[model samples]
Target chain A: MKVLPYFVILPLAGSFLVIFIDSVLKDRKVRDTVADILANVIMLTLFILTLTLFGQSCSYFVGGWRPPFGINFLLDGLSHLMLVAVNLIALLSGIFSINYMSQYTARRHYWALFLLMLTGMNGVLLSGDFFNLFVFLEIASVASYALVGFGTEAEELEASFKYMVMGAVASSLVLMAVAVLYSRFGILNMSYISAAMPGESFDWLLKFSLFLFITAFSIKGALVPFHAWLPDAHPSAPAPVSAMLSGVLIETIGIYALTRVIFNVFSYKSILLANLGVISMMVGVLLALGQTDIKRLLAYSSISQVGYIVLGLGLGTPLGIFGALFHLINHSIFKSLLFLNSGSVFYRLKTRDLNSMGGLNKVMPVTGATSLVASLSISGLPPFNGFFSKLIIIIACVQSGHPVLAVWAVIGSVLTLAYFMKVQKLAFFGKLKEINKEIKESPFFMSASVIILAALCLATSFILLPGVRNKILTPAVNAVLNPTNYRMMVYIK
Target chain B: MKREEKNRAPTTELNGMSEIVKTVCNWIAGFIFLFGCYITAYGHLTPGGGFAGGVILAASFILIVLSFGKDKISPLLPRKRAEMIEAAGGLIFIFTVWTAIYAGASFCGNFIFKKWSCANFKLLSAGFIPLLNIAIALKVMAGLFLVFFVLSITRVILEGEKLKMVKEE
Candidate 1:
């Protein structure tokens, strides 16, 4: 409980500390190494700390003020799960960036902004109040907006601008919803809102605010309807950044927050989430099929994969929820692996266009092999993590008597396989390009990061085992299923 | 007369605005800055806090920048120095929070006032609130000034090279 604040503190401190070091150090190479080492150390420490947090459910009130009067940091099943994912991804991404980020100037700024973004995500996960969540959301969003344009090229800047505009709209909606909720209940703590939700005249107002939340999260998540910025924004970001954004960020802020609000705070359910999920699934994959740019295709596939998670959760069954949570973790691992693979490719070749490359496996064996694992995993091939989660979701759908939706999901999975196979064939399998003979493998740090993620892609499928499921995924499922439990966990002294 | 005119701040490209405007800005900016300090100090008892006061402090500096142009102000408060100040402010805040652990209170818990009571309604009455406020004020002031300086210095070309590029396009 005492350690909760450090989750926010360490990263926040690391962010400025790097910037300070950057100014102090004269040698650019030494400065970059120090920043990289410092950032990775912080991330490693946090990831270990998160592992220690498993099976714990408690709340740490800031300044020792009790809830309803003071802000709190809630570490329950849901938060614990998110903390693990965010920290794990952050750690890997930081490691990957050691060599990858050296390509860009002001590499210290990248480390600083990256740490700041981690602080925001961690803050969002632990924050027990609505307003604090919004603040943290802005912190993460703004860092990402700056990072997207870190290249400072015209196209990168334009993409950053587009992302910023969409992000601003989403933020405004979030603020409006918070205002509406505050006006009605006069409280910003989610637990208090949940406890006080059974009143009369403000029910419609509550629904309106909930609508606003869904819309806001939809935009942030890049669901089909509000997804204009994602294809542009995600692809424009540096590969490690793209990995973080596509893999962890959308799920953390978009899916996790949306579910927490709807399931826990409001205790409400509608077919709306399901509808959005299905549409994003179909549309995202279909649009991805035509894309020549590898990163853009991966970005679209993220939307599609997020659709699966959302769809599973929207079913409102325990099995469905379990599948959703499982899929969430799996998606983070594989999608990040895929993006890092793309980054490695881009780092060596200086291009993201799939059409320009051929037979990359001959030279860049690590990237080729790991990306193959990632691609197969994402395509839901048997023996990998993605297959289990997709299978569970499809089965959960059928069991819940949504067979049509289950069929739609299967079709979505098949389409996912189709596109990934296309990615592999075009980018890795064919004859080597005439001009690509000089291309060497990515640096050690990049390959190691991707290899670790690829291994985790195989390893995470073990989560479906009964013992592991009981220990990890079940608690998270229970947390989602019982909204009232959130209040109880927070109030536990 | 020539010596007096020279003693007066030169109205070169570096020195901005009319003599009257520069004189008024120089005279008033100090008072505005003092007022901002007062707001920050009394934040615990007053409506205006660090953020509000910091903005005012930034406004005073910005006035100096407007009256005395970039060349005049940049030397006095360069971007590097401002950034350092901002970073120092943030470090001070984190240090203060960490101090709570040594003071045997929770993180961000009030250490000073809780340990030794001061008279109510005094500047030192609130436990570490003033310190936090001061830190925030420094950070915000430096941060905003840096932003203003950067923006003010930015040269957006709507003509010349950009127009030529547009024509080429």
Candidate 2:
């Protein structure tokens, strides 16, 4: 508990430390190495620390002030699960960046911004109040905006601007909703808000604020109509950044934050949310089918997968929530792997267009294999983790007498497979491009990151086991199922 | 009278101001910088805190750059040194938090001299707020100046090239 906030503090320190070391050191090699080591160490440390918080539920108040008076760091099953996914992806991306980012200038600033983004994600997960959530969300959003334009090319700038505009609008909506909630209840802590929200007067003001939340969070999550920025923004960023953005960043601020609010804070699942989820799922996959850029395809697929989670959550059943939570972790794993695979291809070939490349497996065995694994996992092939979660969601749908949703979900899954197979065939398995004769396998670090993720793609199936499920996924399911338990021990005056 | 006229001659550039504005700017820049420091250092006891003071200090530098042109005054506060200052400020803040934790308090906990020593509301009364304020001030001051400096440099290069092209033609 004493070390809880360091999940946020360490990354903040690491970012500054990277910049400081760069300024002090004259040798570029030494600076890069030190920055790489520091970034990996920070992520690794946070990973271990977050794991230590597993199986325990506690809150740490900043400055030792009790909740309702001062800011508190809340750790429960849901945040703990998110912490694991965020830190794990960050660590892998940090390693992958070691070799990949060497091609870019001002590696120091890149590392600094990366660390700041991690700090923001961790802070978002841990903070127990609404205002802090907005602040951390801004931190993460600002860093991502800079990162998407890290290349500083014309298209990159355009994409970043689009992302930033949408992000700012969403943030303002969130702030207004927070203000409304505060005006209604005179409180900012989520637990207190949840405790007080149950009065019979779930009135127009409250409903309006909840509607604002749905709009704000849906925009952040990139649900259907709100998702235009994602395809452009995710593809424009550098590869590791693409991996983080497509993999964990959207899920953290978008899916995770949205669900946490609707599930716990609002403690009510609207039918509208469910319909939006179905639309996102169908629209995202269909739009993804026409994409040639591997990263953009993966980005669209992220929206589709997120739709599954939201759809499951919107069902408002134990099995639906379970499936949603399970799919969240599985999606983080495979989608990041897929993005990293795309990054590797981009790194070696210097292009993201799938049509321009062919037969990469002849030169890049590890990338080819890992991406194949990712492709399989995401397509809901048997034995990979995606299958189990998708199966559970389908089961939940059928059990809840929503076979139509289950049918659309099956259609979405089939579309997912078709697009990924298209990606694999076009980019990896056909005749080697005559101009791409010199393409080489990615370095050890990049390969290692993907291989580990791909391995976990198959390995995470253990989560559905009774014992493992009870320890990790079940607690989170319970946390989401019971919003009233959020007030645990933090006596609300 | 001839020597006085020479001393009062206007600057060379079309956009630059006359000598009086430049001289007044140079004179007030130091006061602005000092006043910024005064506010940041006593931020614990006063209303004007680190963020406000830092912006003021950065504005003083921006004023000098604007009046004298970036080429003349940037040597005193170059982008390199500004980035260094920004990083150092961040380091100071996180280190302070780390020390608080190392002393068996929580992160951001105030472990330094907790109780006020006297009845007087001295500048050093707070345990960590002043220190944190100074660090934030340094970061904000350097960071804002860097942003101004970089944007100005880009504009200079673009416009300077056009000027060179006109000269060549």
Candidate 3:
């Protein structure tokens, strides 16, 4: 419990250390190796450390100052789930980057920025107050802006600029919301704010701040209305960076932060969340179906999938919350897997256009097979992780007397299947293109990262069983179900 | 604006500003730096803490760069060295945070000079606050310098591009 600070410290230290090593070392090879090894080690350590907090919850106060006087890192079931997901995806992305980033220069700076992104994510996950959350969100956002333009090409720079502009807008909105909340409640600690919220009736200032919070986070999560930046930004980054941005970054800074604010801080429920979720689901898939670029297609799908999570969380039922949290993890695994697979394809072919690829499975069996698993899982095929979560979401929808919404959810699943099937057929199943005849499998690390994530895609479904659900999913659901308990986080230690 | 001016010889005229600017910068930069250090050192007791002081420190370096040019500053504080200092500043801050644990307090707890009387207004009385301030100042100073250096070089590149466009025209 006392080691909570390490979640923030380790990645931050690694980020700085990589910069130091890059500046000091004369040889590019040694510096790249040192940076790569240092980043992966820190990520792996954080991942393993998160695994230790599976069933326990605690709060650690920074500088030994008790809240609401000092900043704290709260590790409850919700944060535990987010921490595990973020660190696991970050480790895999780091491994994938080791091989994927060689074509780019300044590899050490890549590692430094990548680790800084992780630091921001970890800090965001652990932060106990609104201000700390905003700070961490900015850290992650700024690092990601640089990374999206890491290629320094024209398109990448333009995409980064667009993303930065939108991100800054979202950040300012978030700050405004935090200021509103602080001004109204006279507190910054989420628990303190939540403790005070129930005593007063809904005020106009509170309503305005809540509105800002929803809009800002929806933008970060790349829901339908604010999703213009995602397609450009996701494809422009280096592949590992794309994986992190789509699979982890949006979920943490966007959805997770929104959830904490809404469910834990305000404990308010509205039909608007569910409606927006449905819109994003339909619009995202519709947009994705027309894309020829592999990464862009996946980016659109991320928006649609996030819609499912929001819809579930919006239902405010235990089953709905469980489904949302489950799908959130499942999406992180398979989405990152799919992105890494696309990276592998780009690695071998030097092109992201799906039409240019054909019979790739014959040349890169590992990439093809993992890509297939991820695609199927994402499309909600039976026995894969996505199927269970999506099914749970539908069932919860119907049980909540929204059978029409459940049908719409099913329609969304079918559409997801349709596009991915198009991807698998056009890119991997046709005759090998003449230019791609000499293509080979991706490097070991890249392939290994995808294979591991693909296996997780299948393995994670087992958590849906009764015994496993008791240990993992139940606590998270309970955490969502009872916002009052979150107020105790500040009082506990 | 002429091609010849664009490709001027590598001498004093090409490298730096006028003698008046250089003289004024030389006279003022050191005092600004000293004031920044004073602010950082006494940050815990004053309104101008690490961030304000650090901006002042960076302003001093930026003033020197503007007056004396890249060649003058590169020999003293190269970009690589500035980057290293920034990273070192961050590392030292983390080190201090962890050292508090080794000294038998929680992470970032005020382990150094914890037993000192808080009623006194002295330099070293605010144990780790000043240390944290110094670290922050170092990071902000170097980081700002690096940003300015990068922007300045980029402007030079833009100028070259503009010259090429003129030649093409």
Candidate 4:
């Protein structure tokens, strides 16, 4: 249905509408109400469409032309899953931002940029062509660069500049790869490339392109070595923006593209994928342990959590794929919740320095409690979503006969717990400082977003139940496990 | 400060030959600017694309500013307006893609309003590819121009203010 594209279109439209309304409308109340209602409505519509599209395979041929030639928008289980996660987080962030962004100048521009970011994420999820995906990725990246520099402080500018340079490099690499693919395959559509890849062996050009793609995607995903920009950039952005960056942007665009390239384009090789996975997992956690800034710590942790997803996907087993997808969803929820909690802390206390914050729990119950839940969830405590996903991944590693990898996974989890526990002790549990004595709870909208996300953090663990798991995770895993099916389904011209 | 001003007199006279070199560099820069425009216009059919073409044009404009000064560039295209034009160019690119969808094609799918299958002899018959190149050229030129212009102005303003302070002291 046309509704498929509207998932991206509506937010983009909302972005412009917010700008228009804010400029024309004089009253702050009217502007706020309009922006709030519009963003919520747009995200709700996307969430509904994602649900409606679930369990069904749909393709939108741009200009009604058939595939292998025309650009196509394919919605299978994987895209559907990512769509739900991205929009849900965007909705929560919009709710959080309603009050939070008021403290900043140019609230309208903030909303505009936020919606554009959502548009970019959704576009990346739904795109079926490489070039289209790159364009949308740039859209999201450029918007994020500006958002990261939104504060206009010296550190923020420095972070933004560094991020822009790295991100631009990544984008250029992706573009070059796409160019090579186009010249080699004589086609730009992914399905076309996948279909054409099997019978023929690619020369060094193709291999070099693959190397570039992997390097670029890994940089975007913030795997350990290429991760310098992340610590600075994530913490430098405004909190809601930080939440979105850490939550879904890396997963959907970076890991998702890498997975698509590995599984569909190049053919999955278990050993290579697994090696990358284990290295990223260990290295990410090791780096994360040294960070003291709250957001920077979470940023490192985001890289490590992404490693878990990759480790699962690289296992190339049904259970592994299921675990990876489940963990992907769970991470989006809790990580965003954690960042939102941090946003709240920044809101009331006016600083992100963890050393400056102490005993905030008594004063800001919603933030403290929600962040506690998020901390436990991220550390893989039981009954929360993270525990089940991590368990599935570790079990998958063991079942796949990589017990050593499983051990490493366990070590990573322990490190995760230790660091987050350190965060809890330092930021939320110590003696209340006189400087923070006057700290109050965040605004109502902000608290509401956190509470909703906290509930999701607990409730999503039930997605591991058999019925729900089969309905959601099975189709997605099937999409990856059977890339041939994807080709057959779309190339029906 | 007075001593530095006095020191400047001999240096300015001693560097008169360098100023002549700078003037020659400026004219060469202007010629390079025209060359870049030619490359951008023909990018779709050749090796260069909007991005490369835009950067080249911006570089040429920037060389002129470097050799001369911002005051000369400002009157031709005010810095603020150039920034606005960059944003507008980006918008135009997005709008063009969306317009294709509105016109019954997918986003960025080029729809020929009228198609003429010409014998392969005419460059004028290149269809929508030429238009796409032009749109990209405009966007890239504006974007790079704004970025360079902003950087140059900021340097001039900040350094000029510092020099003024030194003089006052």
Candidate 5:
């Protein structure tokens, strides 16, 4: 049996299983334990399956039907890379949630929603049809909106409401675009759309559809102007959830989908590249500098980091694309680590307010130390993963003869360092507050997750080693750069 | 049931011109709501769909709330029943989509009775479209009812307590 579909099927099955078991168990400790372990095992298995599929291209048609007439689940180098990132982070988030969610009343409901989210992310990463992608995206987005509101505190509900409204609007816009595409192309399969493209007129309607798609995706991705919802939504969820949102959710669904649609379906438009890239990069950092809430600050930084990735992608060189993919992987690692670390702080401190915190390193060694590593890594310091990706992006920018963009990239990195350093100084480095003297380190599972992600932050730079790069990033980059090959592979088979 | 006594006297004021106006308003609201229902059910046939139809149905519920007040509407559909109906609607929508998978079509492929034909373009003619419309209507009506019911009850509870406290003071 092919293992590819299991990545999505298992999580979807697990979500139902969790709901069913939880309803019977009535929130028993044993049931929660079983659910947590089951979720972790499922994600770990998916991680292994993703690794197995690396460098091996495969596609599964739903209900045993062939493509163009059936919905296809395509697994290639890019998807494999995404699957690994998504599952690895999901696994760690599951681990983190075991301890982090203990304070909440509805443990089973949390796991159910989390699994549903996992199913959505997995489906989005693997879906080969536009409509399938949209549906899965909604599944994930709706789940995330609920998760953000899970706390039901005043701010949490407000944030969730805002997120739901914006997300709903984005979904409607995406659906409108999908309807246009379906009517125009008459086939929902992505590969078929590209194959049928040459003779089709790129009329006003098609262009309008493209514009709608980009606008909707930009909102989902939290790119600058359309990003009002991120700072509020990301910070309100539980720490593990916040980590997932910042780490992988935006990148996978928002950036990855946008890249796929723009490059693959619509073909790359240079005007889209320069205009969107420059504006997002400038606005993302400038806004990030003004935030005081640690998680909210980190959320803005996420916008900035995404800006860097988009800028690299916009450059449209082989090097630029390579850098973009590298940055994407690296950002997922360190940023998730940072968000999880922030969760650790919130776990102990019980407050996300930076001003209220002071010199916690003395009390919480693991959290303080891991956070520092994440901070430095994110700020593009050497020997950490962030530096290599940012360096590559800058090099790509310079090589592309956009000196101004390279300068902005460097400035953004410096701005990232400045804010993270402020976070360190206020929250960890100074004298311990008397009120926080009783504060303790988070539970073992939380610490363990942070350590693992922090280790990845330091170690992922090795992926740039030619063998490692070829084994992983190259195939993904090649997949994006060569959309024609994708068409031929799917159609010829 | 004990609370019903307190509301009985106020409902007596719903008489004469007020009663006629209320009935007419309810009829109009119900008509507009049923129109929304038709649009949602025939969405796959025409332009309006589950969402548009759902919104229209909700508007009808809102209109009923505005014209007749909460007590009058509450007896017709209680909170729990509304919640259950909404849940059922959601289930129906999901089930309808899932059927496509079993039929060897992709999920949500509009595969009721196979082959996309317009022969049944009328109200009863569209295969799953009418069912979808009914599902959306249930979801919308129940969802709106729940929201309005909760809001109304909370308002009464809080205000009643406040009035009682003022009397004591």
Candidate 6:
């Protein structure tokens, strides 16, 4: 409970501290090395901090102010899980970027912004008040917008601009929804809001706010109908930025925020979630099918995979919640691995266009092997973590009397394989192109980052073991399945 | 008529506005900046907080840049110094919150002194809100100035240099 504020404080402090070091230390070598070490250590510490919070649910009020009157921080089962996933991936990406970002200038700014985004994610996850959540959400989103265009190319600039505009509009709508809720209930605390909010007494204004939240958060999340900005923004960023964006950013800022609000606050949006999930599942896969750019394909696949999590959660059963949370973990791991792999390939070949290369397996064997691990994991093959989560979601669907939704999900999974197979064949296999003969593997850190994630792809399957599931995944599922537990803990005063 | 029109074409005392605008700006900007500090210092007890006071402080710098060109204004505080100051502000703000937790309070919990009645309508009484406001004001002043300077100076270099070239041509 006491350590909750460090989640935001450390990252915010680290960002400006790096700036101070960079400006003070004239030597470029020393500056970069110090900043790199500083960032990685901070992220690793944050990851460890999240791990400690498991099964030890807690709440903290800022400035010693009590809830409903002062901003509060709540760490329950769901947040702890997401906190670990986000920080773990953030550390991996930070390590990957040490080498990957050297190609670009303003390396100081990049590291600073990366930590700022990390701070935003951590704060968004930790905050129990809606107002503070929105503020942290903006911190993460704004940092990402700047990072997306860090390369400063015309396309990168344009994509970041597009992301910024739509993001601002979405933020406005979310704020408006928050305002309506606050006006209705006279408070913005999640526990207080849930306590006061119920279908029996809720008026049309509440319903309108719910729609505003769902639609706005969907746009933020890049769901099918509101996903136009992602394909451009994700692929346009530098590789590790792309990895962070697709791997954790979308989930934390978009999916996690939306689900938490819908499940805990609104308490009955399952039908809306179910329909949106099916549509995104279908649309994302279809759109991903024709993408030739490696990162763009991965970006679209992120949308499709998110659909699966949403579908599971929308089932509103304990098993379904478990499936959703499990899939969320699997996606963050494997998707990050795939994106970092793409970044490594881009680092060597300086391109994301799939058709420009061939038979990279003969030369860059590490990239080949690791990407294979990631691809199979994402495709839901056996022994990998993704397979079990996909299986659980499908089983949950069938058990919940949603046979048709199960079929659609299975179809989506099959489509996932088809597109990934296309990617592997075109980008990593086939005849070796003359232009790519001298291609080499990535720097040491880049290789290590992907290897770590690929290993995690296999490692996360252990969470399925009966004992381990009870320890990790079960509590997260329980937090969402029963909001009353959260209310009692947060408002126990 | 042509000579009278030429006299009002907005050319300056060399590179900036007329001497009157520059002189008036020099006096009033200091007052505005001081008032901004006043707001930030008393933010906990007053209506104006960090954000409002920050904009006001930034406006003073913007005013200086507007009347006097880049040359006259930036020499007082270089761009790099401005950035370092901004970074320092951020660090100070974090430092306050970090210390609060170490003082046996939660994160961002005010634990400096007299935690109970510290904020009881006193200027220096509020544990850290006033200091946080000052930090924010510093960052905003530097950042807002940096943005104005960069944009305005870029125009000067791009257009002024081009215009000089045109005159030579």
- Candidate achieving the largest DockQ: 3
Scanning candidate 1 chain A in windows of ten residues, the lowest lDDT window is A198-207
CA deviation > 4 Å runs, candidate 2:
A199-201, A489-493, B1-16, B113-116, B155-169
Candidate by candidate, in order, the iRMS in Å equals 12.0, 12.4, 7.7, 10.2, 9.6, 11.8
Task: Please give, for residues A147-228, the per-residue lDDT of candidate 5 as tens digits.
Answer: 9988765578789999999999989999999999889889889888877765345788788888888889889988878989
Q: Candidate 1, residues A264-284: lDDT per residue as tens digits? A: 998886666876899999999
DockQ of predictions, in order shown: 0.22, 0.29, 0.38, 0.11, 0.08, 0.30
RMSD of each: 5.9, 6.2, 4.1, 6.9, 7.2, 6.1
DockQ of 6: 0.30
What residue pairs clash in candidate 1, if any at all? Answer: none
Superposed Cα deviation of residue A57, candidate 6 (Å): 0.5
State the lDDT of candidate 2 residue by residue for A1-493, as single tens digits: 7777788789998898899889889898998899999889989999988888778888887876776767888888999999999999999988999988867877889999999999999999988999999999999999999999887656787899999999999999999999999999998998888888864458988998988888888888899889989999998998889889888898889888887888888888665776788899999999999998888888899889989988898888999989988998999999888888888888888898999988999999999999999898888998999999999998998998889999999999999999999988998899998989898899999999999999999889999899999999998998898887787735521
Residue A480 local lDDT, model 5: 86
By the TM-score metric, which is better: model 4 or model 5?
4
By TM-score, the better pick of 1 and 3 is 3
Which of the two, 5 or 6, has more TM-score? 6
Question: Among these predicted structures, which one has the highest TM-score?
Answer: 3
Clashes of each: 0, 0, 0, 1, 0, 0
- Candidate 3: segments with Cα more than 4 A from true spot: A199-201, B1-14, B115-119, B155-169
Cα deviation of B44 in candidate 1 (Å)? 2.1
**Alpha-carbon local distance difference test for all models:** 0.88, 0.86, 0.89, 0.80, 0.80, 0.86
Question: lDDT, candidate 2, residue A290?
Answer: 98
lDDT of 6 by residue, A1-493 (tens): 6778888988999999988888888888898899999999999999898878778788887888898899988888889899999999999999998998878766778889999999999999988989998999999999999999877555777899999998998899999999999988999999889878765556899989988998888888888788989999999888888888888988898888987888888876455687788899889999999999899999999889989988888888888888989999999999989999998888889888999967999889999999999999999999999999999999999998999999999999999999999999998899989988888888899999888888899999999999998889888888887878877767643
